[model samples]
Target: MWVERYGPKNIKDMVGNEETRISFLNWLKDWKKGSKPAILIGPPGTGKTTLVHLAADELGYNLIELNASDVRTKDKMTQKLGPTLSTHSLFNGKSLIFLDEVDGMYYRQDRGGIEFVQELIDSGRVPLVMAANIEDDKKVIKLIRKSKVFRFRRVVPRLVELYIEDILKKDVAKLSKESIRLIVREAKGDMRAAINTAQSLAGLSTEELSSVVSSRNLAYSLKESFEAFFNADSQEEAYKALIASKVPPRDKVKIAYLSVINSGLKGDTLIKALEKIGEADKIVNMIGTTQEWRLLRYLDRLLAYSLFNTLPKGSVSYSEEDMPWNLKVRMWNEGKVLKDIGGRLSKFLHISSREAVSIFMPYLLVVIGKEKKSLERFIRLLGLGESALKVMVKESERVFLKVR
Candidate 1:
């Protein structure tokens, strides 16, 4: 894969998040027994794990990396790591314990997983580092508060483009500026995805790009699959495009929704298109919850039908990098607050957390902001703390700004 083939050779070779990278390096350099563990929180392909490996190599610490999600139980994790955590010496080479995707450990399934990790941090024997792609989970928030949390923003598109260009140049691969732009835009700050897509298209010509559906690797790329679906001349072609896609059914629904919303369609057209997409999404979710794998057969046809004639050809493009990095940071910082609100609202209204955030929170915040009594009542009812109230106030302000 291009990802491994073009992997950073050293810490300096890594692109973007320069400040965080330096801070992380310094943390490793200065690490000692009893030093606080560090956690890297960010989206995928943002160099969190890669930074750890590179730092371990350059700093000469024996690297012991594990996926927390894979070690399902507290007992198992302890069995695997307890010995290392308790033993260290100058005679023995220094060791770094890196737990990747710590946030992915589900407490319900992996009982006391975070608690064991907490205990390891207290041991303070090894230089510990953890990374997570999400910050909103309650256990993850607990870890964040205890550890030295370093926030990583998504890599800017220009950097990703430049990096891809460098890789292509080194490999003697030729790609048009238009093709490169499409890959970068579709990659949406994921360097791994960008490189993988570039590798898939390395030798293809511009004419081949249009008919890339005939090629399985090209069809497997989510961006190309979406493009093929949107531009297909007939319903069968659109359905075939969806079938050829390697993207999961649930993700297909989500990408389709984002693509439609960002496509600049308006009035009834947009409304009707979203309605169909929503229908598909509901079915997808139902199939997941019920574990009715047979229902998946209808998914491609449904998605193809959802957008068919919904817009003129190529009007609805893929939209992955819609949110700005600054806004993304604000969202991450307030993630726990949002999760709290969603949890409370979901229980009170008997809706899912997703619905609580997407459907209720905005309007609820607006109403409470305008009416002091309602705000008081809601805070009391939801048991919302100052942090949640602060989030509510900020979100209400956003609503008002948009309204104005």
Candidate 2:
């Protein structure tokens, strides 16, 4: 993999977070018994682990690294580090004890683990360095109170671009400026991910590039995924974030539409973003109606390339609270009504309920709008409830006017 093959070899070779790196190096160099342990906190792929590895190499300290998340219980942690707490290596050399993924350690799962670490710190037996993807965890908080904390920010875009350009120069790959921008923007300041993405795109044609970018193996939490999608600088960047997310396609579309509406976007930007989303919705509906799943491939491009220029960067963020409580309740009630109407129509028209909603409902509403008496006739024939009929009427008028 390019990430491994092209990984930074030394402290100076690493990108971004210069001051923190320097401070960490100084702490390692000035190490003594009774000194405070240090914690490196930042997002993933920002060189937290890499820094420690390089420091160990440069300083001649044998690194004894443990993943705190994996070493769940205190017993496991003790067994791993007990002998080496203040001792030399098998070679009788000094050692550095590094605990990584500290944020992933949970009190319940890693019972007594954080306390054991505290004990280690108080003992002040050896120089210790810890790394975490976030600092908000309770276990991490306990460590922070006693440790000197260093923060690492995401690598800047220009540095990432320069890094990749040098790599391409050596590898003799000829990717376009546009394709390189896609990889860089999509990486979102993750140096490791940037290298991996560039490796994936190194030899692909333009037609095949979209698939590679869309299918890139990125796993983000729902909130993270939505934020990345909405905050994307280009439509392609947003779409890549969307498709790369593990979110289900239907939920992805719903969230994308909801985010666009609530994002506070204005004027032509709002209109264009919504227009692209609407096109995506139509494509989603078409796939639902035809059961031709292959059409799903087009959604990424339709959303990304089409809306890239209009949706402002950092204009949208994902929050459950972004949606008003009243609107949510109304949507829930309306969904039940729509389900009832779809169910009745499914049986009446000998079609699936999904088809009834995705393909037939708009036309049915248009028909009822044109001929008022048809509403009563159809309601009786389909056994539609009064509440269902009211919803149907309201939806029909909305659909009718939209068509006009």
What tens-digit string does per-residue lDDT give for candidate 1 at 1-404?
Answer: 77898989899888989999999999889887789999999999999999999999999988877785476578987887766765666357688888999988887888888788888888788888999998998878988888899999889999999999899889988887877887887788988888889988886777887566235334557777888888899889998888887778888888888888767788998998988998998898898899998999898888787667677787777777556445677888799778888888999899999899988887776666776567767777888777777777777888878767
* Model 2 steric clash pairs: 235-304, 235-308, 236-304
Q: Estimate each model's TM-score.
A: 0.57, 0.55
Q: What C-alpha lDDT values do all the predictions have? A: 0.83, 0.81
lDDT (Cα, tens digit) per residue for candidate 2, span 13-83: 88899999999999999998789999999988889999999999999998988885475578998888877
Best by TM-score: 1
By lDDT, the best candidate is 1
What are the runs in model 2 whose C-alpha is more than 4 Å off?
89-92, 203-207, 210-404
Candidate 2 least-lDDT 10 residues: 212-221
Report how far residue 264 has shifted in candidate 2, in Å: 11
